[model samples]
Target chain A: MPRTRIPVVAGWFTEDTAEEGFRLLGTRCSGCRSVHFPREDDHCRNPGCPGGELEEVALSKRGTVWSCTDGRYRPPPPYVSDPAVPWVPYTLVAVELAAERMVVLGQAAPGVGVGDLPVGSVVEVVPGVLEEDPAADTVHTTWHWRPVAVEALS
Target chain B: MSGDVAVLGAGMHPWGKWGRSFVSYGRAAARAALDDAGIGWPEVGSVVGAQTVRGGYPGYVAGATFARALGWQGARVTSVYAACASGAQAINTARAQILAGMADVVLVVGADAAPKGFFAPAGGDRPDDPDWLRFRVLGATNPAYFGLYARRRMALYGDSPDDFALVKVKNAAAGALNAYARYRTPVTAEEVAASAVVADPLRLLDICATSDGAAALVLCGMDFARRRGVADPVRIRAVSTVTPTFPRTVLDLPDIGTDSAVAVEPSPESFRASIARSAYEEAGIGPEDLSLAEVYDLSTALELEWYEDIGLCGPGEGAKLVREGVTALGGRIPVNASGGLASFGEAVPAQAIAQVCELTWQLRGQAGDRQVPGARVGITANQGLFGHGSAVVAVR
Candidate 1:
C-alpha cells in the first residue's frame, strides 16, 4: 500500500493530482494585484495601496531559473533530515515567475544538481516528498522545482 | 553633517572563540574605549549597547549588563539588535543622544559569544517567522544565499572562480597585518581553491565563520571633543539607516520569496547600493572622495558586489576592480582594510562598530601597516536581517 501523503505546510501548495497537477499556492491582493508566495493571507504588502484583502491564489507553475546552488554540509536544525543516515547534498533553486514578476525559492527535484541547470533555464514546480516518518508510515510532501526542456516552457 | 559626533575613542576585545561570556567582552571593550578616551565611567552620561541574542537574558538588556559590570553610574541606557547591523544602530543611538543634548559623552558597545557551526534560527515550531521557515522548509543556510549570489555573479558578469579566490587572497593579506583579526595569516588563491565547497561556487574559506568578539566606541559632541583637549578627531559625518523600498526584487536572507513587482516598479538601485548612497548623499561626498571602505564581506563574492554597490566601480565591474588591484592596500580605494568579516568572522553585534573602529584608526593615521596613505574619508556598509540598513561615513 502507498504511504499516506501530507503537506509539510498546509495551504502553501495544491494537493497532488493527475488532472490539476501540483502548483505552489500564493495570495494576490485584489486592490493592487500584488502577488506573495508562502501565502500572505492577512493584508497586501504594497505600501501605496490602502490595505486590500489578500485572497488565495495559485502561483505560476513554470518559471525561469533566477539562480541555483547546492548545500554540501548538513544544515543545522530546524531542517529535519535523518541524522542516523549520512547527509545527501541538495540543490536549491530560485525561480523567477514571469507572470507574477517575483522569484520563489524551493528545493530542486532529487538528482537535480547545480550543474544541471543554467541561470536562465526554465523550471516547473511539482509535488514531491520532503521527508518520510518511517515509524509512522507517513510522508511529508512539499513543492520541488525541476528544469524543463529548452522548448517546453519558453 | 550638521550634528557630527567625535569618535573620541574606539576599542575591541579581539576576534576569536575566547570561551568567555559576552558581558565580559562588552565590559572589556567599554573599559578599553574609556581608557583610550581618558574618560572615566562617571564621565559617561549615557550608554547604548548592541544586543547579542546568543548571550541569553543579559545579552538582551546589554546596556544594563555592561553598566552593571562597570559599576552602576545611573547612565541612561539603550539596547538595540539589528542582527549584523546591531553595532551601527548602537552608535547611531549614542550619536542621537549626544546631538539631543541628552548626554555629553556616550559609550557605545556591541559584543557577541556565538555558537560554533552554522548560525541557526531560534528553536521552535512556529512557521510565522521567515528565518525559521527557510531552514525548516528548504534547509537554506546563509551560505546557500551567498552561493546563489556568487553563482548569479558568475553568470551575469563572467566572473570566474579565480576572481572569487583573489578576494580572499586580498582580504587575507590585509587581515594578516591587523592584530585584532581572527585569521591573521594571509591566504593564497590556491589555498582558497583547495578548500572544500560549503555551498556551490563558494568554498569553505570564502564564507565567514561565527566568532566571539566585542567592539566599543566613545562618541561625544564636537564641542566636548575640543573641551577635552583633543585638537583633531574622527567625526561621523553621516549614518544611513534606511530601509528597502517597496517591490524589493532581490532575494534577501531569511526570506522565501522576493517582493512582487507586479503593482509597482522596483528601485533601479538595489538595496545594498541605496545603503551607501544614502550615506554619501548625507555627507555631501561621493565614491570618488573615499580614502577607504570597510564593507561586510560575508562571502568573498559579496565583497566584490559591495564594490559596485558602494559605487567604487560600475555594476558588473567589481571583478575588474579586484583584478586591477584598485581595491587592495596601496590602491586608489582600499576596501576592508581592517580585514573585514573575511578575517574577523562575524561577531554579529560587534562587527559594524569594529568597522567604524578601523575607519577611526585609518583616518587618524594610527593604523600601523594597513593604513591607507593620507586617508581622510572612510565609509562602512552593512545590511542585516529584516531590512535593517547600515552605513557610516566618517572623516578626519
Candidate 2:
C-alpha cells in the first residue's frame, strides 16, 4: 500500500504544490491586524488590541533570507531522523516576508545547503516531506524554503 | 540606593558534571552561603529556590526541597521557574521579601543536574507547545539559533570567525584562574578554530555545555546589615526582570517566528538591550560606571553580542571592542571576568545566580586571581525563554 500523506502539524501549511496554492498559513488579528505564524487561533496577541477574532491568512510565498545556518550534528528527539542511516546535515533558513514584516523559520529544500543561500537572497515556500515513517506507512509533510531562481526574478 | 538590598553572602558548588543529585549541590551551596553570612540556616527568615525541571518532582518545589534538605525550621519558602533566568528571579523574590519587611534575611538557592548534550524539550506529542514544535518541525537546537545570530552578525556587521574565537580565548584565560569553573584550561583562538563545527558559524568550543552545579546567595535589607554591625557591604541595587515589549522583532530561542512589526513599531532597543537598560535605570547607573560585568556567554559570538546589548559599546562595535582588547581583563570594561558560561557551561537554574555571585565577589574584592582591581560596581545580564528577562546590578 502507498504511504499516507499528512502534515507534521495540521493547518500550518497547505499540501498544495502549485505556486498559488503552496504557502505557509498564519492568523491575522481582525482588531489589531497583527500577524502570527503557526496560526494563533485563540486570540489576538497584541496587548494593546481589545479582543478580536483571529482569521487564518496565507503568508507570502516568497521572502528574502534573513539568515541561514546548517545543523552539522543531529538534534535529539522528538526531532525525527532514522538512527540507522548516516546523518545528513540540513540547512535552516529564517526568511523575512516583506508584506507581513515578520520572519519565519523553515528547513531548506533537499539538496539546498548554506552555500546556496546568502542573507537577503529571495526564497519561496514549497511542499516537502518532514520525515517518512515506514512502520506507520505515513509520510509526514512539512514546508521547505527554496532559493528563487534568477530567471524567476525577471 | 534607598531600595538597595545588602548581599551578605554568596557561594557556589563548582560547576561540573558531578553526577550528583541537584538537592545535594543546593544544600552544600546553601550551607556555604550561611557560613559566609556568619549565620545558621535557622536564622534565615525565608528561602527561595530556582526550579530545575530535569530533577523531577523535587525540582519543582525546590524551595521546600532545599529547606527540607537543610532540616526545615518553617521559613517562608518560594519556588520560581523562568528557564535560564530562574536564578535571577529567585534573587528578586528574596529581595522583594527583604524590602517588603516580610523577612529580615533571605536565602536564595538554585541548582541543576543537566543531561550531557543538546538540551531537549520535555517529551510527548503535544503540538500546542512552541518549544516542542520547534524541535519537531525544524530540529532547531539551541546552537542552531546561536549559529543564526553569529551569521547575522557576520552578514550585517562584518564580524569574522576570528573575532568570535577571540572571545573564547579571553574568557578561557580568566576561567583558568578560577577554581569554580568547569573548564579551567586557557584556550587559544587557534584551538577554537580547530574545534568541530556543531552548527555552521559556531564550533563546539563556541557553545556552552550542560553540567550539574549550584549557587546560593544570602540577602538582607541595608538597615538589617547596619544593625548587624556591618557598616558597609556589597549591595544589590537593581534586579531587572522586564519582559519584551510588543512587536518583538528579534528571533529568540524556541520560536519559529518573530512577532510581526506591521501593527506596532518595533522598539528601537532590542529585547536584550532592554534587559540591561531596565537594570541601569533602576540602579541609577550607566554602562560607564560598570567596573566589570558577567553577561551570559552561551556562545562565544553571543558574548560579543552582549557587549553591545549591555551598552559596553555602540551597536556593531562589539567586534571592534574585542579586537582592541577593550573588554579584556584590565581593559576599559572587562566582561565575563569569571569566564562566563564558556568556563562554567550552563546549570540553567544555577547559572544566573552564579553571575550575581561573581558580581558580589568582585564588588567585595574577594575574587582571588580574576578580580578586577578596585572593582566597585558590576552588572550581570541574562535572558530566559518565554519572555523572562534577567539582569542584576551590584555595587559596593
Candidate 3:
C-alpha cells in the first residue's frame, strides 16, 4: 500500500507546486500590520496595537539565511527516527524574511548540509518529508529550505 | 538601598549524575543552609522552592514539600517555576516577602534529578505546543540552537572553534578548585578538539550535561542580620526578572521563529543585554563594580555571549576577552568562578540558585581556591525558557 502524505502539523504550509504554492503560512494583524508565523489565530501580539483581526497569509517564499547548523546526534522522540539504524545528521536553517522582518527555523532540504548555506545566502521554501511511518502507511510532510543558485539571481 | 535583603547563608549539594531523588538533595541542602545561618529550620518564617517539572506533582509545590520534609513548622510557603531561572525567581519571591515585613527570614531552595542524555520536552502530541512542534517538525534539539548561535558568532565576530575551546579550558581550571563541581578535572583545548561534535561548530565538551543537584539560601532583612550579631553580610541588592520586549528579534530556545519587527522597530539592545541592564539599574551598579560573575554557560559559546550581554565587554569582544585571559581567574573580571554549568551541568531550577551561592561565598571571602582576590561585588545572570529574564546582584 502507498503511504499517504500529510503535514506533520496542519495549516503550516502549502504543498502547491504553483507560484503561490510551497510557502509557509502565517497570520498578519489587520490593525497593526504585524505578521506572526505558526499562525497566531487569536489576536495581534503587538502590545502597542489596540486589537486586530488575524488573517491567514502566506509567508515569503524566499529569504536569506540568517544562520545554519547541523544536528550530529539523534534528537529523542517525538522527533521520530528509528534507533535500529545509524542516525544521519540533518541541517537546520534560520532564514530571515525581509518583508515580515522575522526569522523562521526549518530543516534544510535532503542532501543540503551546513556547508552549502552561508549567512546572507538566498534560500527558498520547499516541501519535504519530516518522517515516514511504515506501520501507519503515512508520510509526514513538512517544509525544507533549499539554497538558491547564484545564476538564478541574474 | 531600602530594597536590599541580606544573604544569611548559602549551601549546595554537589552537582553530578547522582541517582537520587530531588527531595533528598533539597532536604540536605536546606539543612546545610540552616546550619550555615546558625538557625534551625523551625525558626524560618517563610520557605520558597524552585519547582522541578520532572519530579511529578510534589515538584510543583516544592516549598511545601521541603517544608514538610524538614518537619514543617507551618512556615509560609511559595513555589516558583521559570525554567532555568526558577531559582532566581524563588530568591526574588523570598526577598519580596522579607521586604514586605511578612517574613523576617526566608529560606530559598531548588533541586533537580535530571534524566540522562539530551533534555526532551514532555511527552504528548499537542499541536499548539511550540516546543513539541519544533522537535517533531524540524528535529531541532537544544544543541541545534547552541550550534546556530556558535555559527553566528563565528560568522559575525570572527570567532573560531579554538576560541570556544578556550572557554572550556578556563572554566575547567576553575571547576577543579570547586568542591561541588561534577567535572573537576581540568580539560585541555586538545581534548576539546578531539571530542565528537554534538552540533556543528560545537564539540561534545562545549555543551553542558544534565545533572542532579540542589542549592539553598537563607535571606533576611538588614535589621534582622544586625540583630543576629552579623553587622555586615552579603546583601542581595537586586533581582531582575524582566520579560522580553515585543518583537524579540533573537531566536531563543523552544521557539520556531522570532517575533515580527514590522510593527515595532527592534530594540538596539538584545533581550539578554536588557536582563543584565535591568539588574544593574536596580542595584545602582555597573559592570565595573563586579569583582566576579557566574553567568549561565549552557555552552562555551553561550558563556562568551553572556560576557557581552552582561556588559563584561562590548559587542563582538567576547572572544577577545577570553583570549586576553580577562575573564579567567586573576584577570580583570573573573567569570564562572564556581566553574559554571560547564563544570556543573544544568540542574535547571537548582543551577541559578547555585550561581547565587557562589556569589555569596565570593563576596564573603569564603571561596578558598577559586576566590577572586578582594572580591567585593558579584553578579549572576541567567535566562529561563519562554520570556523569563533573571539576574541577581550581591555585594559585601
Candidate 4:
C-alpha cells in the first residue's frame, strides 16, 4: 500500500498546517452581526435577529480550557475503535471562546492528559492522530487543541 | 384558544421495517385515513406532507411527491422538513390552512422507510456542518449524547441504572400490546442489562431503534365537523412549533458545542419545556389538567427528562414518579400509552405524526388495551435538531 496521511476531512483545517494559527471556519450574519460557528449554510439561525445573509468567517485560534473529561468506554458502531486491544481513555477538552460566544469541543493534543491541563489555561489547535487501523493501512488524523506552553508564546 | 379544528380521521401503515419506499407507506396511510373519514381524494381541500430524509433525494420536497402519488388533484400542497418534528409541523400547517378558511378539510401525512443502525447526517466532506463534524471528528453517535444525559441524570438525581432499565420495562410492556409497535416482546431489566452496550450507561434496550412506519391524519374546520353530524370529535387544540431561545444551555445531538451562558442568563425553561408550556397556554390547560402524555422517548432516560420538562413531575422527581409506578398503566398518569419510541423506534418524520395518532386513539376511547382511563386531555412533546420544537395538545 502507498504511504499517505489520511485526513478526516478537508478544508475545515489542514494537517501539517502551522501551529501559530489553527481554527475552524464559521459564518457571521452581516445584518444582525451575530456570529455562528460550524457555519450556517442558510439564513441566520437567530429567529428574532431580523434578516442577515450568512458570510464565511474564521473562528478563534486559541481559547481558555473550560472543563475536560474522558470516555473510558468504547463508543458505538459509527465511532471507529478497536475491540481487540484494551480500551484506552482519550482526554476531551471544552474551550470557551469569547468572540463567537460558544463552547467548542476537541481532543487534547498528543501527550496531553486531563491531569496535565489546568482549568482556564490557554490552548491552541494542532493536528493529531485520532485512530489508527494498522491492518487496513489507515491512520485517521484530526485537529486537536493543545494547551501550549506559556513560554512558547511571545 | 384560536378557531378550533376537528380531527376528522387518523390512520397508520403500522410501524415496522417492511423495506418499502416512504411514498408507499405515506400513500397507504393517507388512503386509510381518507377511507376512515369516508372522503374521496378529490374532496380533500388540501394536503400537507412531513418529510423524511430517509427517502433519499425525494425527501428534499415531500408535499409534491405525496400529491403526485395520490394523483394530482390541484390541492394546495405544503411539505415540511424538521428532522423528527416534521409531523407536528405538518399538523400545524394544516391547522393554519383550516383556521385561515383557506381549506375546510385538509389531509396531513408523515412517513419514513428508515435504514438500520445509528442515524447519520448527510454524507459529505463538509467540516463546517456540526452534524457532520461530530460524526467525522469524534465519531460521537446519537447514543453517546443519550449516554451523557443518562450519566448527568445519575450525577444530579442519584438515579441508578435500574431506573433507566425500568423505563424500558414499562414501555416494552405497553409496546407488547400495541399492534402498531415494531417490537412486540415485553422486555425485562435483566434483558436490558444484558443487551450490548451501544453507549456507556445505555444498552441497546435502553435506546430506540430505527424502523419503517407511516401515520396520517385528516383535519377539518370545527363548523365542518359539526355540520357533518360529528358533534364531539377529537380536536387539536394547540400545535407548538417554537425554536430555542437565544442562549440554549443543553448539549443537543449532532452539535459538538453549546451556547455560552456568560453573555445572558439562560431561560428558566429549556427548549423542550417551552414547547409544552406554549401548547398548554394556547390550549388554556395546566399540567394538573392533563390525563395522559406521549413524549419522545428516543432514550429511556430522555423520557424521564421529558417528565420534568413537560411538567408531569417536579424537577428531578422523574425517577421517583417512575419508581412509584405513577407513569405506568393503572398509575396516576400513564405515559407512552402507544409504547413510545421504545416500541416504535426512530422513524424520524413518522414518529411525531405517530404521537398524535396515539393521542387521537386515547381521546376517542379507541385504544382498547393501552387506553388511559378517561383521557379527555392529552399532549405530545418532541424536539428536532437545530432548535425545531414540536408539541401538540388534543382534547375530546
Candidate 5:
C-alpha cells in the first residue's frame, strides 16, 4: 500500500520541493508587524497591542546560523527514530530570521559535518526526512537548513 | 485586592511508576484533601483540572476525569493545559472563582501518567512543530537543554559538576524523608558522578524522572474558611501567572529558537525572574521574608538557576548557596523543601500543584522530616513549556 508521506501541518511552507527547498510560512500582523510561525490565526500576541488583521507571510528563505549542536543519543518515543539502525549523530542548527525576528531551528543538511559551520554563518531552508519506520511502514518527512556554499572572501 | 483565598487542604498521591491510571491517583488525592479539609465532595462548588499529555493526546482532564471517577455532583468543571505549570494555573483558576463568589469552595486537581524515559513530542510528520523539529532534526531531548543550562552555568558562574551533584545529594536525602517522593535513597557525589551521562555535563541523576502522580487542593473564600472553622489557615496570598515581557532572549522549552535581540534590548529581568517578582509584588513580601521555597528543580543545575531567578541569591551565587548548605533543610530560606522534582520526578500537570502542596504542608508545620524549622512563609515557582510561568506565595 502506497501511503502519501506529508507534512502533518498545513500551509506552513511554500511547498515541498524535490530538492527539498521550501520557505516556512508564518503570519504577520499588519498593525504591529509581529510574525507568527504555524501562523497564529487569532489576534496579535504582542500583548495589549491594537488589533491587527493577520496576513500570511512567507518568511525569509535564508538566515544566519545562530547556534548548532547535535544529540549523541536517542530521544524518547513519539519522535520516530529507528531503534534498529544504529544512531547516527546529526547536526542541529538555529537560524536567525531578520524579518520574523525570531530564531528557527532545523537539522543541518546532509554532509554538513560538525565544525563545518559556526555561529553567524548563513544557511538556507532545505527539505529533509524525519524517519522511515520499517515496522509501521511510513516515511516521515521534515525540513533542514543547508550552508549557502558562499565563496571564501579573503 | 490583597484579600486572598485560604488553602484549606492540600494532598498528593506519591510519585512513581505504579502502572495505574491517572484517574485513580487524582481521586485518591482529592479524597485525601477533602478529608483534611473536613468537607464533603458534594459541597464543592467547582472543580478545575490541570491537563496532562498522554499517548499523544491531551492528558486526561483532571477535573472531568477525576470528577467522573468520584461521580460528578454537578460542580462547575474547567480543564487547563499549560505543560508543567498546569496545576498552579488550575489553583489560580479556582482562586479566581472563590474570590469572585462564583464558588465558595473549589477543588483543584492535576495528575499525570508519564511514559518512562526522556519526554518527547507527539508522533507525526510535524515539521512545523518546534518541539518535534528539535527532536527529529537534532535529537535534542529535554536533557540536552539541561546540559546547555548546566554548561552555561559552569562557564558563567563556574558551577562544577560536583556542585550540580550536591543538589541531588541534598534533594535525595530530603526525599528519603518524604514518603511521597519517588527516589527516597540519599545520593552521593560519587554516585552522581558514576551515573550514566544522558547529556554532556549532566548525569542521569542530575535530571528529574517522569513518573505517575497526582495532587489536589481545597480552596475557599476567606469568609467561607472562617465559617468552616478553619481559622488562620495557610492563605494563598498571591498567584503570579505572568508572561514574559518583550524581547524574551532565553531559549525556553518546546521552542526551537529564541527571540533575536537585534531589534530591541532584552529586559533586565528575565521572564523566569519576573514570575517570582510578580508573586512577591502581589503578596507584599520579599524573598527575605520567606522561610522556605519550592523551586522547579527539573535538573540539578536548573535548581541553581532557580536560586538566582527567584532572587534567593545572585545569578552566579546559586552553586555557592548550595555548597554553603544555604538551600537545604535547616539552611537559610531552605529551597526545594519538598525534595522538588529531583525527588518526585515530573508528573507534568500535577507538579505545580504538588509544589504548593509542599508549601501548604510546610506552612502548617506538618511536613514530618522535611519540614523547615518554624516554617512560616513559603514560595513555589515553576515554568511550563510554551511560555507559561507560575509562582505562588503562601503564608501562615
Candidate 6:
C-alpha cells in the first residue's frame, strides 16, 4: 500500500499531476494585483487600495537565489523531526520571484548543501517530503528550492 | 522643532544568564534609575514597561508589575511589546505621555529572563500564527537568517570571514571595558574563528546568545528637569517606533516571504534604513552629527548592514567601514560602544533600553573606560520581529 501523502500546510501548492505542475501557491489581489504566499484568501493586504477579491494563483517556479544557509543543530520542536535518529542538516534558500518582486524562503532540495548553490544562482520549486511518520505510515509534504544548472541560467 | 524629553537618569541590571525573575531585574534597574536621578518612586507620575514573552502574566502587564514591585502609588501605567523593539516603544510611549503633558515624570523599564538555546515560538498548534508556521515548516532558526545575510554580504561586497571576525574583535574590545557587559573578556579573531558553527557561513560567536537582563530610564519634561536642579541633561531628541511601509521587500524574521511589490513600488530605502531616516528627520540632526552609535548586533554581519541602514555609509560599503576601523572605539562614528548584543547577549525587551542606557552614560561622559571622548550625540538603532522599526536619537 502507498503511504499517505499530506501537505504540511494545505493549499500552498499545486496538486494535479500535470507536467510543470509543481508550483508554490499564492494569492493575487484582483483590485491592486498584490500577491501573498501561504495563500491569503480572506482579504487583500494592500493598504492603499480599498479592498479586492483575492484569487488563488500559482507562483513562478524559477527564480534567482537571494540567499541561503543550513541549520547545524536540531531545532526545537513543532518542527517534526524524530529524536531517535541523528539530525541531518538541511539547507534553506531564499528565492526572489521576479514577477511578484518578493523573496520567498524554503528548504533546499534534499542532498543540496550550501556549497552546491551561490547567491544569484537560479533555482526552481519542487515537491518534497517535510517529514515521515513511520508508525502512522504518513509523509508530510512541503515545497523545496532546487538549484538549477549553471548552463540553464541563460 | 520636535520637542525633546530630558533623560534624567539611566540604569541597568548587568546582562547575564542570572537565574532570577523578570520582576527582580526590572525593579532593580528601576530603583537604580530613580536613585541616579535623585528622585523617589513617589515623584514618578507614570510608568512604562517593555513587555517580555518569557515572563508569565506580570510580564505582559509589565508597567503595573514594576509599579507593584516598586510599591504602587497609583501611577498611570503602560506596557508595550514590539518584539525586540519593546523597549524603544516603551520609551516612545513615555515620551509621548510626557510631551502630551499627561505626566511630569515617567519611568521606562524593560527586562527579560530568556530560555536556553534557540528562541522558539510560543507553544501551540495554531496554524494561523506565522511565527509557528515558519519554524515548524522550515526549521529556519534565527541564525539561519543571519547566515543568509552574511553570505549575501560576502557575495555582494567581497566580505570575507576574516572581515566578519574583525567585528567580533572590535565589539569584544569595547565590551571588555564595560563593567556591565556579560562577556567582559576581549576576544580575538582567532577565538571567533575557532568558535563552533551554529549556522552555515556564521559561527557561534557571530550570533548573540539569549540572556536574562533588565534596563530602565527616568524621563521627564525639560521643565521638570530644570525644576529638579538638573539642567542640560541628556535629552531624547527622537524616539522612532515606525512600522514598515507597504510592499516591504526585505525578508525579516517570523515571516516566510516578503510583501509583493506588484501592486506598489517598493520603498527606495529598506525597512531598516527607514527606521534611522525617520529618527534623523525628527531629531534635526544628520548621521554626520553622531559621535557614537549603539546598534543591535544580533550577528556580526548585521552590524555592518546597520552602517548603511543608519547612513554611516552607502550600501555595500559596510565592510569597507569596518575594515578601516571607522566604527571601532575612538574611530569615526563609533558603533556599538556598549559592547552590543555580541557581549550582552539578548534580553529581548531590555536590549533596546540597554542601548539607551549606554548612550546616556556616553553622552554624560560617565561611561568610565568605554567612554566616547566629548560625546554629544548618540543614536540607538534596533529592529524587532514583524514590522517594528526602532531607533532613538539622543543629545547632550
* A-chain TM-score of every model: 0.94, 0.95, 0.95, 0.82, 0.84, 0.95
DockQ of each: 0.90, 0.87, 0.88, 0.23, 0.27, 0.83
lDDT by residue for model 6 over A78-144, one digit each (tens)?
8989888998999999999999889999999999999887998889999898998879999898998
Reference-based TM-score of each model: 0.98, 0.99, 0.99, 0.83, 0.84, 0.98
**Cα-based lDDT for every prediction:** 0.92, 0.92, 0.92, 0.82, 0.82, 0.91
Q: Write the per-residue lDDT of candidate 6 for residues B81-190, one digit (tens) a residue.
A: 99999999999999999999999999999998899999998887979988889899999888988999999999898888888888999999999998778899989999
Question: Could you list the CA RMSD of all candidates, in the order they appear?
Answer: 1.2, 1.0, 1.1, 5.0, 4.4, 1.3
Tens-place lDDT digits, model 4, residues B42-96: 9898989998765266786778888899999999999998878999999999999
Name the better of 1 and 4 by DockQ: 1
Which one wins on DockQ?
1
Write candidate 3's Cα lDDT for B1-396 as tens digits.
799999999989999988988899999999989899998787899999999776367878899999989996989999999989999999999999999999999999999999998888888787788778888888888889999999999899999999999999999999999999999999999999999999898999999999999999999999999999999999999999999999999999889989999999988999999999999999999999989899999999999999999998889999999999999999999999999999999999899999999999998899999889999988999987788879999998
Model 3: how far is B185 from its true place, Å? 0.2
The candidates, ranked best first by DockQ, are 1, 3, 2, 6, 5, 4
Off by over 4 Å in 1: A151-154
Q: Taking the tens digit of each residue's C-alpha lDDT, what string does model 5 give over B170-279?
A: 99988899999998999999999999877667788999999999999999988888998888999999999998986676667777656544335568998999999999
What number of clashing residue pairs does each candidate have, in the order they appear?
Answer: 0, 0, 0, 0, 2, 0
How big is the positional error of residue B103 in model 1, measured in Å on the Cα after superposition? 0.6
Candidate 6 lDDT for residue A38:
70
Q: Which ten residues in a row have the lowest lDDT in candidate 4 chain A?
A: A69-78
DockQ of 4: 0.23
Q: Score candidate 4 by TM-score against the native.
A: 0.83
lDDT of 1 at B378: 97
